[model samples]
Target: MQISFEEFVTARGPALLRFAYLLCGDRYLAEDVLQEVLARAYRRWSRIGGAPEPYLRKAVLNQYLSWWRRKSSSEALVATVPDRVQAYRTADELAARDEIWTLLATLPRPQRAVLVLRYYLDLSDSEIAELLGYAVPTVRVYAFRALGRLRAALSGRAPTTEARSG
Candidate 1:
């Protein structure tokens, strides 16, 4: 059975916004991008009125990638600090996290997007590829390389036992 757009938005809005936040790492920009994607979805409602979940997610991902391409760098996206961060006993963890984020900013946009989607959002490779218009193996490769760089970036301060990715 089909649902109304209002109902669809009500169900998907928060999740979509969270995905945006994960990708852009900016709450404000995430909100803005979410609004923009929803507007586009609304405009193409008839064409994408069914199975809108993946459709909307793909739009959001494409919008983010497009915006990143136009921006010429991910520094503005990954270089900024999260609003609230944990205070560490040695301050080394915080410093390392900061440095990792900085190195993340230096990565190419697609790799950063892959890391954000795979680890940060905990999305499956096929789901990421579907959303980002990449091949499944490509997602795997990008995520693998991103994690390798991240491990190197925070080498000394690596989690003792393996904690969740932020």
Candidate 2:
């Protein structure tokens, strides 16, 4: 059965916001993107086919990429520190996570998107390729290169200029 736009948003909005935040690496920007996508989805609600979640998610990703393209040159990289530390986690774990996020922020948008889709979202390479309009091999390459840079950074070595350019 088809659900109304309000109902869908009520149920899925938080998750969508989280996904967008992960993608854009900025909570405010994530909320903006999600709001725009949801507004568009509401206008086309009746025309949207089955599995609206996937459609909405794809829309968020596309919107994020479009926004990045427009403001990339003006964007500043910042380390996103949690406002409150969880009592259960060790300091080292939090530090590592922060370091990884900082490194992730430095990656090119497409490479970062591939890594996020593959690892954070746990989507298969083919699924990510389709979502990003890339070939499977291209998706794999992005993941490989992204991971290589992360590994190099974590190991206290700098990635070569060639790797950075790609």
Candidate 3:
């Protein structure tokens, strides 16, 4: 049975917001993405043919990618402490998170989306491929490339184009 938008939002809003935050890496943008997706979902609630969660998630991902693409060329640099940081923790972890996020933001949208869907959402490669309209092998390649960059960055090496060539 089709549930009302209110019910759907009440049940899934928090989870969706968390997913958005993971994808966007900013709480305010995450909230915006959720709101934007919910607004679209609201308009189509009656005509929606499937479970709305998938539709909502796909919308969030697409919305984030669109925003990223439009702003990427002019994106600003910012420095902030990670939320997970503790007073007792050394600066290394915090610095690592900053570097990671910086690198993550630099990633092509598809790579970021694949990594978020696969790792953040814990979806399988095939599932992520279907969700993102990629072939299974393509999904694996994106994951491989994204992880390679992250690994290289953490090791204090500049990410190389060698991964893209192979």
Best by TM-score: 2
Off by over 4 Å in 2: 72-81
Model 1 lDDT per residue over 34-80, tens place = 89898977877877856898778778888887876676444443335
Give Cα distance to truth, residue 121, candidate 2, Å.
2.2
Q: List, residue by residue over 23-126, the lDDT tens digit for candidate 3.
A: 88777778877898888888888987659888889999888878766754454536555466578767887777677878887677788889999888899999
**Candidate 1 — which pairs collide?**
none
lDDT of each: 0.75, 0.86, 0.82
Which 10-residue span in candidate 1 carries the lowest summed lDDT? 157-166
lDDT of model 3 at position 65: 73
Q: Which rank order by TM-score, best down to worst?
A: 2, 3, 1
TM-score of each: 0.70, 0.89, 0.81
The candidate with the higher TM-score, 1 or 3, is 3
lDDT of 2 by residue, 1-166 (tens): 8988888889999999988888888888889889989989988999997689999989999998898778545656564566888999998998897788788888888898888888778999999999999999999888888888988898999986646766
| Residue pairs clashing, model 3 | none
